[model samples]
Target chain A: MDLNQTIRCIVKLGGAAITCKHELEKINEENLETVSSQLRQAMNLGSCSNKVIGMDWSKRDGVLDISSSLADFDDQRQFTVDFSRFVVVHGAGSFGHFQASKSGVHKGGLSQPLVKAGFVATRISVTTLNLEIVRALAREGIPSIGMSPYACGWSTSERNVASADLSGVTKAIDSGFIPVLHGDAVFDDRLGCTILSGDVIIRHLAEHLRPEYVVFLTDVSGVYDRPPTDPNAVLLREIAVDEDGKWSVVKPTPQSMNMQVEITVAAHDTTGGMVTKISEAALIAKLGIDVYIVNAATIHSLKALRGELRHNIPDDWLGTVIRFSR
Target chain B: MDLNQTIRCIVKLGGAAITCKHELEKINEENLETVSSQLRQAMNLGSCSNKVIGMDWSKRDGVLDISSSLADFDDQRQFTVDFSRFVVVHGAGSFGHFQASKSGVHKGGLSQPLVKAGFVATRISVTTLNLEIVRALAREGIPSIGMSPYACGWSTSERNVASADLSGVTKAIDSGFIPVLHGDAVFDDRLGCTILSGDVIIRHLAEHLRPEYVVFLTDVSGVYDRPPTDPNAVLLREIAVDEDGKWSVVKPTPQSMNMQVEITVAAHDTTGGMVTKISEAALIAKLGIDVYIVNAATIHSLKALRGELRHNIPDDWLGTVIRFSR
Candidate 1:
């Protein structure tokens, strides 16, 4: 099998991709296709690294949600499971936080910052759900599978281990497959359990895959210097996340303290996400990994680690970059 | 689709069926065939109950063995995904426990006994592994799926609703699909995070599903008069578990005092097990539900509750029925 030694990119389809809560399904679709194709084209031209794309969500593990998905028509919607170029990992936000609390380690201590009692199972639902959605996608021959703290190992406490059955993605990658991963609720030791978002999982891979760039594909066009809703808000070309959460990292527009960098990271309550992603990516950056926090919906704007463009776009309009340095 | 209606059975294939510490491949094919035939037969006989069988060591949740399952298959195969008939919660025992503990959770205490620091990732792995196994089983067209505690109304604490979907199992059951659950380590309210077992899950289900007969399928035949190791240990025809752990109603077996039911009543460190099964069955009996505690391995001599041949058996062999009139 010819495993490409060039730039390997692991694309994490944000949770927003599935819920479409306030986003449009068509928009989500177009962005994902563009992202997939761009990654695929780069890999094909030997211009990219190991390519992987994952579907991510935190609240879709409910039984009803999975059932309702049964009626979804096979098409790009099927791309979620295309194991060839993508390995999917999703979240389980809505499955049973109440039930988890009842039996979770994070018992009581509300308003006490972040509690991890039910987080492990919480994150796991994300990782497992991603696999299922991918399977649903696979039904259409999208060639997809997954590996998480549960399956392979994007673990929270210890060293990450590659799953023995890498064939799922190995074959796909050999055949130009795109592997996927997303934010997940993985089992945590200190606090019972925890969540591993698509951002972190992607960055985790960046540590090894050493992809040219890692992108956070969300619904927004890109990080705004200020709140998009606020006319006075400014946009950020790029920002950095201090491992200690001491610096200010803006998201184009800071909608709330949660949207911008804050004291405690999102890994605690799992709400303040950007800070967590930056911190995690910073760790990967020390290993020579660079990441891109972009509006995943705009795949045409993905860039290379060397600041090369994945798409033929005007330099002025290209999205921002967040490089990690030692 | 014409769904059949008749006497259907929910059978639990032992964990050994899917995962063996020694040779995993040995069990897969045989088990699949054996279970497939059994399910088909149960379906043809009656479909009302829904003949469902799932892997205790579900692929998604992973496995959790207190001890190493890497030894001989049956020697001390203590680890398996133990959940309810709805969700197959799994875990990777030795592999994950270390990882979870390393992540850190204070294990022991004074009055609470030695709190062996358990792994936190265990909670995540157990649930995810089980979910994956459920999906795997479902994909194989086993008409089975895994359930999470959130869907089963397991809320030890308040609030913190799970974002993941859980209604799939309810739908499957309503659609006549047999939902399977296993013992998973979920974040708990009281005990940081605790392990859940299939036995406990079934016990919990008895509170609802109220099956006419609750049978535990084990590797051994049935309750032995003496320890099976003694060769002279005769099989106890029946032993009833009373409401209070006091089986005063029936005459104790010859060596009854020495007989300790191997089960953990407390939910913290232990999962529901054989000892807990009887206790739970006692509750079921109170609801006028008849339960059969038999070693499923010896099911060749399986006796249906309605079978007439049982009339010829000795009263003791019939079972020490503990009536739950309350």
Candidate 2:
């Protein structure tokens, strides 16, 4: 079941992006459908990356049209991959955050005996959500297997994943089935028990599996400066790690003041919020892997992430790209 | 959540005991209800070991009657434990056995790459059964937390449980919630994946937790001299490990010809049948713990195991007892 070779991308469905985090145990079905549909289209594209090697479409007089070079390829015929080689990891969202926050399961370390109930409750919540998402994907004609990280994930004394048996995951991917995993309560050597966030899991997986791309489908369009809520807040389209390993945001200057920031402020997140996501993404970026934080609220955003709507390039996409400069 | 001291018993609901193993995905609701009701009754009997130290009832001509000795104790009152310190383990039965057997998951070793689908299929089957049992227990007013062994169970290269984290299980018990676990597809170092039987899981748990009693509720009355299916089979009421640590069963002789064999022949059991169960129980019995194998088709058997009906001891009970002689 080893899939380290074929899988080129890892896409994560943030809990807040798929479920109504403020509502108890509610799933945002519309957003979920959009995400699933996009994944299907991307998988159908067959070995296509967002690199945009050759121009297939051109724009003239503000009108986009297919170029003569596109005549050789049938645009409507979907290309199939050797296999759909992508792993789907999801956040706990409302299913886990409430119980984990209430019981401190996410905080880690030794806890009071009563907190044990919280761990069980949180597990039930998240696993239930995992099943629902898996079922939905199955309805969309995608064969997905739902698994709890607790089933094979282990944590170290420091409460980070020490050894994770990903054979099952790799096997599922190799067999052309999507392996769906979610945040779960895992045993820790030092902490007794703790919550393993989906964000952290995706990063750990990328490091080991070496996927070429990692996409985080979130509620917000992308990472914003100053929490996005400020009137003057602006979206940072491209963020990269400098030679010194410091993060820098590509900003519009006097050379391009006409460009408007397209991102809105991030809503409140119980699971470390957007700040934590960025920091985790940065670490993956240092590995020379591309990470995208894109909103799935609109179909256009999905297209951008799938590399299907590449005529506009970075300008047409509503997301933030985090990568390391060669 | 520490329960190393509080929990004194471990009860396992064999898949054959609670579900129709011959039928696919069918649960024996009647048997399940009886088992749950009896467990509820046992939990209500606080500090009451099988010893029945202070009599709550007296018998007159094969009839059970409340005695004057129980006048001080409220007959209607259900005394709760400081904590409901017991763990309930269940087998996968039809849900897992079919796929595991077909995939050779129970056969412990490296497998063909194609067996990966079988692993995922088996997980879905078992976890579905686990959720069903959890829901039933919840209906019986038992706060049972459902967990898969894959969540915390690890196996050696030989496929035996190498390192298992029972902290959450212990915590669940210490918090007064029944920790319900079931056989599952777990990652193995030697085998890419293997089946962790519920029978094996119970033994591993007892070794770590050192519970005072272990009750294996099965479809049959108890262990027999030969396969219960044989016509001349006789129930072995009491089995114990001898000086050399070999298992031996008690049988009636000419001098005790008046004694009657109380167990009936065991029905079909795909999970290694009753013989495997007895072997596992014998190992636990050698550790100074009492193990009971009783039929769950009747409420009386459950009551007998719970010590609620204890007039005739081993002689009156319709089951086999495995213990170590001092």
Candidate 3:
């Protein structure tokens, strides 16, 4: 529990797990509390180094009112720039896609991050959801900031924000805090703007932080030989990142890209399946750093990999531990 | 001014006309008061029946909260029920489309209306807008009701409503109150659902009432011989509702159905415009009713029509009052 420990792991959480596939209305405080406790434990597990748990916002509330955003953060004097030790790249589902689409308006139209402005009412709801997340995080003593790609000016020449000042995350981490980020749409060089998935975000971070290991905690048990949907699907406990990425990889359907991450853990009940994370892991593992893919239920595995938990035990065999030879 | 003596007109107010479109903000009260005053003067000038101004809502603050709807009717005990004198067919812009597309789920995707379980967020917005409109009408001392085609059903086989059980509207109007309706997608027998417009509500009413003179009002000046933007355009003072429906006909594009109903009376505007009024006029005018097309600004014209302020008699036109036969 020493605060002076050097951090070893820089874990990026997928939106599905953090937002609980958005099933619990808001952040699913029960799950968050549990995840929060695990993250805290992992952070303190090792006297070696303090780990940073980053977030890839699972969803965003599009209907943010200046008053509400201000009121929600006003007394505490919190603003859009107040993310924790983690830097973030969040999504706009919380903003207005609902309203924009309702009006048959897809502003960019099949372009990067596919958004329209007509869904004003839906944005209103998303705004509520976004506030709920903020409130829950705040209550947990976790300071979180909310951002949307449509409202924020983070884009690359090809996309919107290439390296979107993930500085919010880095600063949070540097300040001895847990920086939380989320899956987002970033300006892209290739597609004008592409979804910066939680896994993709880790890929982005790997280029910058060069951390020893990147872990993805999700609801699913782990990666599978085939789609987990099938009754006969078997769990693939472990695999070399490069070996599995090329010969075996699954593409995401039109509805989602999260499921297409190279190699990561997944929840059985969430929208994005293991196939998506597998893709993300493969992409990050290529950077020569190791990745620990595990169910959020057992985040201790993350701490174990960080040399924090000194146990050699592999519980559940329900997770994957990925590493690089470089 | 005696309340009952006020000339009655059903003004279908567009959500855009009254709201700060993207900001989701209400129109300021000072401006609203002026608009309401102009409405009163217009009422005094017109021979039309008691006016019932219906608000076409774009958003609802809450289901139980009807504060915005009751903006103008501060004098009486405002009553709100899901009852209507007019079968208002309202467009569900900023509520349905973007949310549907965002969820990658469509219930009644254009091919029909309310066909799917749909997104929770989209449904909330739709319901909220309905409440706002209904609530506004009630506040104005106008007995009002909210109606959605999903609840009533549509004639999918013919891309229309075979029969809208508009018992609510009938009861309201029969009680000597104005019935209001708007554009809306309804459950259909064929396409599974179809969108019925507010104009059609008037058309159906015409089939029943068959008034001697029907009035049409809207945002723009009356229909013109050429596009209004053209320099040589001439205002179309008289529109012939003929067998072919060549004149007084408006069509809907994917972007907007409002175009067909944009005609209004010129400066010196009269009562406000009802977009589908022209189409309704076409349907009823064919039955021998003379429909007057005027803008809300033409106050003097309304006074002349009401036999209040006399129109100046031109010396050259004194003995030239020859009636043209249709």
Query: Could you give the C-alpha RMSD of every candidate to the true structure, in order shown?
Result: 19.5, 12.3, 21.5
TM-scores of all candidate predictions against the true structure:
0.41, 0.69, 0.38
Ranking by TM-score: 2, 1, 3
Clashing pairs in model 2? A113-B1, A150-B151, A151-B150
Top candidate, metric lDDT = 2
Lowest summed lDDT over 10 consecutive residues: which window, candidate 3 chain B? B316-325
Query: If the candidates were sorted by their lDDT against the true structure, best first, what order would they fall in?
Result: 2, 3, 1
True contacts kept of each: 0.01, 0.08, 0.00
Which window of ten consecutive residues has the lowest lDDT sum in model 2 chain B? B51-60
Per-residue C-alpha lDDT of model 3 across residues B58-140, encoded as one tens digit per residue: 23332323233335544322322212222233333344434344332333432111122122223334444554444443334
Candidate topping TM-score: 2
Candidate 3 lDDT, tens digit per residue, A48-120? 4332212211223544222322233223322122222333232333233333343333232322111211122
Off by over 4 Å in 3: A1-8, A20-27, A45-107, A110-115, A118-131, A143-152, A156-163, A185-195, A243-273, A299-317, B1-326
What is the alpha-carbon RMSD of candidate 1 to the true structure? 19.5
Residue-wise C-alpha lDDT for candidate 2, range A1-326, written one tens digit per residue: 25656576888898888999776778898888778777766765655532211111112233433333224433322322233578889997777676677657766643342245456556666777786777555434454667678755445446678768776577556545677888888767677778888988998899888886888888877777645565665667777776556666664342453333322223323333776787789889898887888887576556655654323445666678887876
What is the TM-score of model 2 when looking only at chain B? Answer: 0.79
Report candidate 1's interface RMSD in Å.
20.3
